[model samples]
Target: MGDIQAYLASKYMSGAKADAILSRSEAGRPKKKKRRIDQAVPVAVGDGTGLLIADEDSLGNGWGQAEPEEEDTDVPVVTAAAKTLRLKKSNWSLPSASSSTQPEPAAEEPPAESSTATATSAPPVKKRKGGLLTAAQLKEEAEALAIEEARKEAEREQERLEARRRRRAEGIEDDEDLANDDDDDVDDHPDHQRTVYRDRSGKIVDAQAERAEQIKAEAEDRARQAAKKDWNKGLVQRNQREVEAQRERQVASTSFARSANDRDMNDELRNEVRREDPAAAFLTQRKKKGPQRPKYTGPAPPPNRFGIPPGFRWDGVDRSTGYEAKLFQKINERSRKAKEAYQWSTEEM
Candidate 1:
């Protein structure tokens, strides 16, 4: 009966269920396999007693192993807890409480490739000891720079002023030399001496009077010369006009005399013809018997009183007697005498 019950339980129950029942039943029993120094072991001293034990190897290993696992077995396992425990033991091991409580070490940073590049390719930045300056120091530096610029500017201005002064001195020397040369020239020529005249009040008056007289004489001379030129021009023009008129009159007189002579000859010839041919003369008389107006024999109207007729004199004097004409003649005579006197005075001066 006992063997049959064992067989039935073995066939029907799982390995884990069997183990659990056995562990409960054999609570005071020792495990078969002993743990190594780096291993974890769970021991059952009695009912409800669970104890874990770790060795020096477990303490020495700071972290659990993380290596890759081998391939799983093809056959299915009957105990999940056992398989899990094995996997835990192979892949990882828990640390002691003291070790777990300790802080972990920080990861080391990777070395930079740029550090070597920078050292080789670039110059180092120099640190200035006096990088940060005080307000007083800054002010002093600015004032020093300003003073330096001002000094340089003043030096340049001084140089320019010195150059101008030198030029002015040279110009003054040249002027003095020129004055001396002029003085020497004046001293060398006695005939070209510059006369300095001084005039008192009376001498000034005499000079002014002489100047006025000279000006007046010059004016009179100009007037006389102008009047003479005008009079000559008028005389020439008047003579030309008279000559033209005489020529025209001569021409007219010659033509009239020729006509008269021709007429007289014709009359004498006509009278001879009349005496020689009384019958012809009687015929001519009969032809000339037409009525004719009497000839105007009265003297022609008096010539234009104001304007001179052809053949009349062109003298500027009027022969008629009137107060105005006499007055005009007197004015002409006075003007002529005045012109003659002016001419004489200018000649004498």
Candidate 2:
């Protein structure tokens, strides 16, 4: 070891550096404490794509063979997120050239987080198509898709509801355009489109069964309508019979007074024997026509609202005496007050 140090010092380095190198080297080094081989960490290497596991076998620089690790009893195993290693200069013998192991290519992991998050979370390495999807994962994805679709449907429904509210507020009479989803061309061309039947649980059912149910319902409806018609006919016939029997009874009850002036007879029959002019009609006419009014045949005058007679004309004269005018003014005041009272009542109503 001293000769090797002297040779190194004379050839390539100072004596102190040579001694330090020899001390740190394998041959003349002191016995070191044994480190657990299992504790050796595997570093991760990046190849511009993703993190990749790096081991000593990759770069032809591996630790020496060591004993198997002791069994762990109480200490929990821990995984480090990352660890850094600084290589120390050493004189290591290269592996045999004939029995070499080739390193695999880099970029084993993905680069993007959003697209590869599911792939990284999956258990299998096969990420193509449905290979990596587990039962639970597939179910979750389906539920998520259904939820998204439901959210979109709810938004559309909300928009439709708002539109309906706007139309109603504007006093528009509209039954159409409430929902375009149902009012599509499919509704107008129902006969041209294929009809699909679905059961109560939304699963597609047999068309024959569905049609049979519809026919059964229609038949039941028709039977009900027929039964109702028969019931109405029976009720009408019963009513007619009762009316005829009542007419016969009335004829029997009123047969005792089958004369023209009988009170039970209708007005048209009684009128045949009625005396339009009574014995005191002359006195009634005298009372109703106490005064006779002369009629005017000329064109009617422009109506004056001041209680003037129809054909009378004012001669620019105040012919009313003072007492008569006072009496007329009082009457006019009373009428105006009555009119005001009527108008107030109308406003309250």
Candidate 3:
């Protein structure tokens, strides 16, 4: 019986299958390492309830009927159970169908009550469009920015005005110092004292007289420059006018010379024509007669034997017309002979 079964098995087994079986058998067919179930460490299921079951044997039996086991005394077992409980709770609370398929999020377990309270109390943050503000919010923000810019500009303007006032004050002080220096200079110089003058009314007028003279000299120089400029301008205009007039005169003279040459050429042509053909010249000079009809005096003279007039023998009639005339004559002769033969035949009959 063992030999029969072995032959049947060998017949059914392929060469590759036999090789695989042989290899596996030679390798001692690796024993599946049994997974150690930590009875103390509670298995967390999808349900959020933290009720602990005894072991795998109890887990296979419906969870509803399974009695809760005593808490493990080991610290690690308690920590792991606590972690699993947190993970289950978080997974249960998540509002996503995909959360069931995903592996448990490996995160530090947060207090359930605190997380729930925060989630409940805080309003859901709405997603923004392109992470940007709405139109109204943007407009308000722009107005605020513009107001801030205007305030800063006003402050800068104020600072500028203050700086300008300070500068003006400094300038005034400098001018006062310069005036004092000028007074000191006047007191120190003997020439200034000698030049100083007062009118009978006791008003100082020497500087005014010098300034008037200086202004008069400046005016004269400006006037001289203006007159020189005007004179130069007039001279340039006169030269331009004269140049234009000369150009016009040259153009007129050239035109007159050309006209004279044309007239002379016409006269020479007339004289040449008179020498070449005097009769043609006389015909050209003759007066033209008015239109008149010719008188019908008589019939034309008969052509000679050669079918040409006496004066037209050298200039014979056109060949095409002569052929037509000969054909007409032959046709007339044939018609006459036919008529005469018909008369003779009638007399004989």
Candidate 4:
């Protein structure tokens, strides 16, 4: 019963549950494992007769308060300085807590591609205007400026080179700088501007103006030599226009030598050979001269192909070309295609 009470109490089981379990069990149940009463459970001790106990602090091996586990801060430390004579060198004092600052995390940088994209997306800045700038922006701008400057400088050099090349191609001195050197020295002569000689017609020949004219004449002579062509005229080509004009002149003169009957037969033909408009006798060729439409009041109409006056408007029909015939052709074509949404001749047909 004591063993049963020990087991039941140890398990914190009620008496009714134990009794029911025991009642359901058969008599052939295995024997319980034996344990000493002192080892199994505590029984009642004597009243007010407690055993003597030592001071907890005076006990060995796990006596006082347990030292807390040291946290793993892993901070570096400095020991006191050792003597220089020793192989292990001097040590320094640890830094003060106030002096130590918590290190901040470094900021993450954007990708290289993103930086370049931003630089390209931004418009080119000629001058770094009053604004904060990024390194990428400055770098791109500097590169653009370098390329632009190099291109401009190359263009100027190319122009200069082309000028020199053209001078050489035209058979002239390419060194244009020295071209005026000869004139510079000569023009500086004291008497270059003064009259130094006189010709027979009292012309100021030695003056700078005369010298300039001489130089210009010499240049013209050189140009004339350069322009000289080797024309060996071999063919005698008769001009039809000139021969016809000569024949017309002879015919006009021959009219005067004709018999008087021929000349006096028509007053108009007789006067026409002598530089006169001789049609005034019969044909009223000239108009009765006056403003035809009394100076148009409004804007003039568009001019026609014929030289008729501005007020004349023609009918819309152009009977000259076969436009009416083509209209019938187009009408037949439209009738043929009217049944279809579009002309199949341009497609499957």
Each model's C-alpha lDDT? Answer: 0.58, 0.62, 0.61, 0.57
- By lDDT, the better pick of 1 and 4 is 1
Q: Please identify model 2 stretches exceeding 4 Å from their true place.
A: 1-131, 173-349
Backbone clash total for model 4 is: 0
lDDT of 1 by residue, 57-152 (tens): 433344543233243453443433422554332223345656653455679876787777666543333333467888887776767666667767
RMSD to the native, candidate 1?
44.0
TM-score of 3: 0.15
- Model 4: weakest 10-residue lDDT segment is 35-44
Predicted structure 1: lDDT: 0.58
Could you say which candidate leads in lDDT? 2
True-structure RMSD, every candidate: 44.0, 31.5, 33.4, 35.8
Measured by TM-score, the strongest candidate is 2
* Residue 12 displacement (Å), model 1: 99
Please write out the lDDT profile of model 2 over residues 127-222, one tens digit for every residue. Answer: 236557788877877776666677679889999789877977998846565455466766778564767778789997778887899999999999
Q: After superposition, how far is residue 210 of candidate 3 from its true place, in Å?
A: 89
Q: What is the lDDT, from 0 to 100, of the residue 83 in candidate 3?
A: 40
Better of 1 and 3 by lDDT: 3
Model 3 segments more than 4 A misplaced: 1-321
